[model samples]
Target chain A: MKQSTKYMMSDGLAFSEKRDLKRLQKKSKEGWHLFSFLPMGYNLQKGEPKELQYSVDYRHLQDGEDQEYFELFEMAGWNHVCSEVGIHFFVAPMGTQPIYTDVESQIDKVQRLSKNVYMTAVFFVLMTVVSYFVSELTTGIVSSIFHYILLASEVFTIPCLMMVASLLYRKWVKKS
Target chain B: MKSLEQLTDSVFYIMAALVQPKHGYAVMALVEKETGGEFTIGPATLYTIIKKLLNENLIFLHDESNPRRKVYALTEKGHHILVKDIERRKTMLSLAERELRGGNAE
Candidate 1:
């Protein structure tokens, strides 16, 4: 069945096969396909029909089916909203999907960044508080819980920082 | 047959919508609602037109006190464009009218 994913706009930073291909090409004009494992099934096997219609239009397809998305935005006071839908349209020859970021995409990105940052900071501070207080109370069970929380937070800090870096690179470094 | 510069369909619709307070989506909605689907501007195009309108000072965003979506109404300059385009369209229609048997009905 043909399908379209409805990921929240905030979930944009996750790299797709399309994005990976573009990154490779940009890094080296003569980039090797190396290990092409893109998910749109863009590749061909012996005698398969040549690839077609791989490139995605980030713009709404304008078919009647999509009229509802157009309709919802019609509500008053929400006029400047750009549709948060971008697609990984595959192109033939050297099939590649360039990252196409628009305002809605950017908004999703900022929201994701802000939320992730806040969540991480909260988690870390909570652990720090627990670590300091649990030992003072001399309650073994509570103190163990605090240590575990601290360890979990230490594990989380790395991923969140990396995520923050990726978000920055996606927004600023690439745009610049 | 016409460059983007010459196409006034959107410009006219926007001006008409903005005669009263209408924002980006409202302009699109108003154009469609009023035109009965005869014309509908896509969101991308509508937002772009709004940016242009703001740049041209033909419309302004809502003040913070409004606590509502940004609505754009025409300025004197925008009104001039709307009027001119209306006349141009009317003149074109008149030419078509002259071709018919009951010519000059108006």
Candidate 2:
């Protein structure tokens, strides 16, 4: 099969899922359909143009219930697409019923996604601190190759913290 | 004896739609028809609500024979909550009407 793939970066956070959905829909209209989801992005295959409505659900599939969950959504008029970790993607024709029907459920989905991201951010921060202490104890306070690696890790931690902070602000500070 | 705290429009309509056993797409169709195009329940919302309702025993799977399309029906508990909610709304509407008439008399 002749196929072309497009890699687009995405924030694996709940708040940004809607943006990703919109992007997928737009790409689909241009004959680029989503083939699979990749880490931090999506892989789309070039194909006949489609006007498909895209939505992503953030839910952890339980043991032995994966088929049931997909069947339920499929029965609801959504065609299941690829899923990555806790994120499930689906598409239906334009005007197909939306997956979320109420504000409470929608908020619940947001909270779940935020919780996952928040926990990951916390874990990263703890790892960075612990590694810094261990490196200091073994390699002395003097700068070395290990010190440079630690510096790079600390820089990466900034974005994780920022992502958590933004999610918190939206969850609590923003009324909506 | 489940007391609902302000059912969202979608939840209310969905429950009402499933007074009879219906599949997922049927519920969506009924909701849209009943609302007269005023509202439509999204698939994501419907899926989540159905799962929650099933967990709370407000709704149950009516049939599992159809692998792709599972049918659902309201449980007894769901009926009780819906009727009570209707009665509550009736009371509120009657009281509002009485207040409006009293002001008119003045």
Candidate 3:
């Protein structure tokens, strides 16, 4: 019963969802099947190396319908691997139909994921602004150390937001 | 009731495939066959559409003795919509063919 696991960094924000899917597929072929999704990475278990087509569907599973949802995919021959919040991951043998068959549906899925990222970015930005104002009011000057920390928060979120915005623009406006 | 105009190509094909009760893979295979391999619905899209169709009463799950596969069939509303869409396509084709024939006569 020898089992081994590895902590592989996965994009939790899902901004690079397509890349992550490719990575997962490649990893699965190398005998690292994803067994769990941690906050900052994926936990993969050692398994027989096989070619698998990994797909991620950004959907908010409603209560009481989770079983049926999985069942539908299972019936379609996709094996459910794991899920993180609104993102569900599945893998199937090569040549299995993609989760999204049309451009419109693919765009819809990306839009939903982008919306979640946008809201999260907004929350982080709002928190930083509020904290900055509070610190300035209390100390009569924004503390340099805390200010840097707050700015660092923006550093990651702003770029992530930009990535999502550009992705949506490319798909919708440019029709790429 | 959802408008027929709102039904995308994938939804339309899935509904057509369900004229007879079918499981997920069967619907995919039927759609591919009907379209001459021009269209294929993936598992994710099919699953989502199935849920939407069920919610709209356009389709219902058929109870099958085999518990492994869940079968689905078109409801009356779904059949009516499919028939209407087919008629619309036929009418459009007739107009196009009439123009083509006129050009050939010229």
Question: Against the true structure, whose TM-score is highest?
Answer: 2
> lDDT tens digits, residues A23-104, model 3?
8889989999988887677888898998998777878977755675677677667888898888777889998767777766
- DockQ of candidate 2? 0.46
Which runs in model 3 stand beyond 4 Å of their true positions? A1-3, A11-13, A140-156, A173-176, B1-6, B18-26, B33-38, B53-83, B99-106
Winning candidate number (DockQ): 2
Say which docking band candidate 3 falls in: acceptable
lDDT of 2 at A125: 80
Query: What does candidate 2's lDDT look like per residue over B51-97, in tens digits?
Result: 87888888999997865567899999999988987887888899899
Candidate 1 lDDT over A1-176, as tens digits, reads 53222111122234343464354333233322222223222222222233222222234333442343333333422222122343322233432211221333333334444464657766776776677677567677877777777677767666556666665555564345
User: What's the true lDDT of residue A93 in model 3?
Assistant: 95
- In order, the TM-score of chain B in each prediction is 0.78, 0.85, 0.82
Q: After superposition, how far is residue A173 of candidate 2 from its true place, in Å?
A: 7.4
Residue runs of model 1 more than 4 Å from their true location after superposition: A1-176, B1-7, B62-68, B102-106
Off by over 4 Å in 2: A1-3, A11-15, A63-68, A71-77, A135-156, A172-175, B1-4, B99-106
* Residue B34 alpha-carbon offset, candidate 2, angstroms: 2.5
Whole-model lDDT, model 3: 0.77
lDDT for model 2 comes to 0.77
